[model samples]
Target chain A: MPTTPAPGTVAPAVHLLAGALRRALLEEGGGFRLARVLPGREDSCAGLAAVRVLGADALAPFVVKGLALPAQDAALIRAAVRAHPAPQEPERQVLLWGIRDAALVRGLAVSGVDATGWEGLAPAGSTAHLLRLPWVAMAAELVRVAGAAPPFAEEAVHAQLARSHLDISRGLVRALLRRDLPSAACLTRWLAPAGEQLTTPALDYLEIAGADDPRVSLDTAIARRLTTGTSP
Target chain B: MTRANTPISPQGDHDDAADRSRNVETETDAAAARLAHQVGERALAWLECMRGSFALTAETPDDHVEGQALKSLAELALAAGMVRREAIAGPQCADTAGRLLDFGWRQVGRGDLLYRLQARTPAATYPMEIYAPFAAAGYRHERMDRLAAHLLGLRASRVIEHVPNRRLAVVAAAATIGVTVPDDVAAMIGQTWLGGTPEPWMLDAGNAYGVTHTVFHLTDWGGRPEGLPQRLQDYLHQWLPVWAEVFCETRLWDLLLEMLIVGTCLQRPLFFPAVWERVAAAQRADGMMPNGLTTPPADPHAAWRNHHHPTIVAVVAGTLTLSRAISHATTAGGEA
Candidate 1:
């Protein structure tokens, strides 16, 4: 016959403990659980232990599983989980909502939604840091969707290339879409005459410019052109 | 007829003297014009050659990368010749000299061309003939000389201080060329020699020597007086030996060309004997010198040896012939 802790105190404490553990598990490098519980009444200890165990293993697999969920529902859970850590703060919740809206407009599944949202949530001046995200897949997906849609044009491609750290020129973007080598080589050659213009910002972008197949000679030629300048 | 029979009067003698003076002045003016014309022609030719080489290098693909090397060597030779000719003949042809001077000054001011020349030629191989024109044009040769010395001295000091192991070859070469090391350069070298602590990279003797040799040639050639036989003598006696050792060890074709330039510029007694020995040792059965030194084997396959060997041998032979002529002239009562 174990004495139960007062219902109000026990419920609030358990909720608060659960909340903290959830935040730690979600935010810390891929969630871990507390192995042992602190000494307490059997019921309270059992609740704490259960929450810790469930929170650690449950959160990761649940989020990973949610990746295949319908885009709308997945977005809702991602927003809920992100906002869960600090529900009292309306601004953070609003920020997470804005990112969810952007992801929805782009038609991307917000699988790593919290990480993605957190990346964009820094204050206005921290945009540079936000831009460092490995958004290649998202950008590629966006480009594909944009191609199918009539509104996406060369202007959109140019803007993306300009803003993104992806090493791609306007011509390279077109080449990527077309999967043509001669056109890519023509652009590369035009940019880097005898490898002189290889290091130009346009060319540097072309070097790490992700494509299904990266042209080594063209990239090298571009790099060389940039370094030495009009190689003669 | 009766007046001439009385022996030309004092007025007639005065007229003749006046006519002679006018003729002399006209000849001088014509000579000046001719010299100027010659300078302009040569300068243009050199510029054209440089442009051609640059174009040739640019057109070459990766597999033909060796074309660039040949172009580089040609450009260096052209630049050296242009500078030397302009400096020597510039005063005699002020207009042409002025143009050439402006060009050289501009190039030197940019710093890149000077660095490139230094990279190619040994420090002691600068053409003394160039300084003569500036001196003739009423420019202060000593001040220019001192400025060059200071610039080279500072560069040497930096290399010695920041990079110590390379100091030996550089310092030894500088000493050989009789390059007056400022107090700072000397101190830095001395400190390094006396077991002063060096950076991690400075511990490798080969790298140190190689880097120092580069700096030495650069500062040395870039630092010499425009025109002075004693300076040339210093280069031949002091600098050439260390370079020879480096040359023998490395057998870099460029180094051989540098040796040739030094031989042509100095024509010192000490140089020809050593150079001839190097030449004799370098000559292959097919009359080709190995493109680069083979000992110490930087690569196992002797991959570095290539077409440049024949070119270097030809350059050395030409330089030797030039040196012989200079030696004869100097010995035949021309200023040593």
Candidate 2:
């Protein structure tokens, strides 16, 4: 079953599979069962896209459900890696390498993954990357699989977050008002590591800024869980 | 005073836009102070040119202060008094401010209309709010102050209902006229939205107005930053930039300047180039900043109706920024 209710009316394959993964994550004590897709080349492509969109987060729900990876779901990670190549840009490579690293770092029951893949993607801890998108998703996956908080501990990252707190907060508010619900939710999740209560009031705005999309719930759920130290 | 033949288009993504934004972000204290003074003066000049258009109509039975032109002139009185009180921006502003103050006082028959209005509704604070600026400038009327003193003592006056920020405005006006009863001020400040120090990012347009007015009242038309407590001061220091960005991007020129005024209300003010550059770019060669992204009307009356408040906001905001910038520089220089 989809974790956060169906998006309804022929949702895209990436979202459908992502929603299933997110649902499995929030289960807390439930078993992991990968959602079944139609048998076609398109289905295989969609699965890899979902795996990329989630990066490490694609496998996080299985870990949360406390299930050892079946070879079939493990094959999804292997296929995603084979399908996607590392990029030259530091941020893009960090994002690309994150999928393989998550599977390895969490020591999932996946096979044929390169142990040295993370070394090829150097500067994996860029400060600017920590401020942008996909970082939050990757971060949420890390938190779920490894019981780690966001790694905003470096001094440069700390200073950057402090200096740009207003900018980040402004982005979230603008997204909420613009009704770009997914971006707003991602920003909400991204701001979870702030020492002060950066968005206690803004959390309510997310409820009112509701979207029909399940990714909104997934991002918001991760944010609330991170901040409150509770299950979604 | 060379006005462009056509309006300077608002900045686009050209290299100059980046340069201008960077210039504002990196200016020295002397540079920032000069810009603030110039911005304030151009806005006041625009207001002075439109002075004749603030025509009053006879009071209708409903007699809402906001529904009458009297409110506009009264607001002009506050802006003029601020320019004169700060008294350091420039002589041109000072001269224009003196003339404008005389014009506003004359428009109200030199406090006679104010006295009559207060007499009719002893509990109505509007006339007294108008009268306070005149009194503060040594233009006090014996009869008006006596009536205001009586009004200030009344239980009805103390209990006159207003939204919390409006209540703070009334209290501020009473302080200017030297007639506020003490506890009313405390209770009023406690009830204001800003006083609560709630999450400022959630502020929409309405709540923003409430917060801006609360700052205007607390700082006493930008005359006294000391009036704002340290807690509220901290709240504004952390939050005003986001509000400024929110308004500037949405093209709410009035609220954007209102936030700029709040910027100056902090105990320690700094030049915010990113927000200020957008505002400077938005102003026309004639000094009119449109209230929104909508093209300003060609008709004078329509333009005035649409833009007068943002113009007034520009005046006060620029002046306060100028005044506070000077204060901040002088203080820093002394410390050095």
lDDT of 1 at B93: 31
lDDT of 2 at A90: 51
Output the number of the DockQ-best candidate: 2
lDDT of 2 by residue, A110-212 (tens): 3233435533322233333333322223333322222112321233455556655655666665555555666667666546657347565566566455534
lDDT string for model 1 (A1-232, tens) is 2223356344434443334333432342433232222224555444443332222121222232232333443433334334333222455334333332332322222233333453322221111222222232223222222211111112233333345423223333344334344244334432332232222543444344422222222233333333444222
The positional error of residue A190 in candidate 1, measured at the CA in angstroms, is 71
Q: Per-residue alpha-carbon lDDT of model 1 for B1-336, expressed as tens digits? A: 232221111112244755665555344333433332332333333333222222223443434435345433433333333344334333433343344444443333323333344444324223222232233333333444444454457544444333453444344333533455544444443344223322211223344344333333333332332222353355334434434443554556445544544443443322333344555455443333355544323331242234333333343234333333333444644531
Evaluated with TM-score, which candidate comes out highest? Answer: 2
DockQ-derived CAPRI band for the predicted complex in model 2: incorrect
lDDT value, residue B308 of candidate 1: 35
Off by over 4 Å in 1: A1-232, B1-79, B82-183, B188-269, B273-290, B293-336
DockQ of 2: 0.17
iRMS (Å) per candidate: 40.0, 13.0
lDDT of 2 at B300: 65
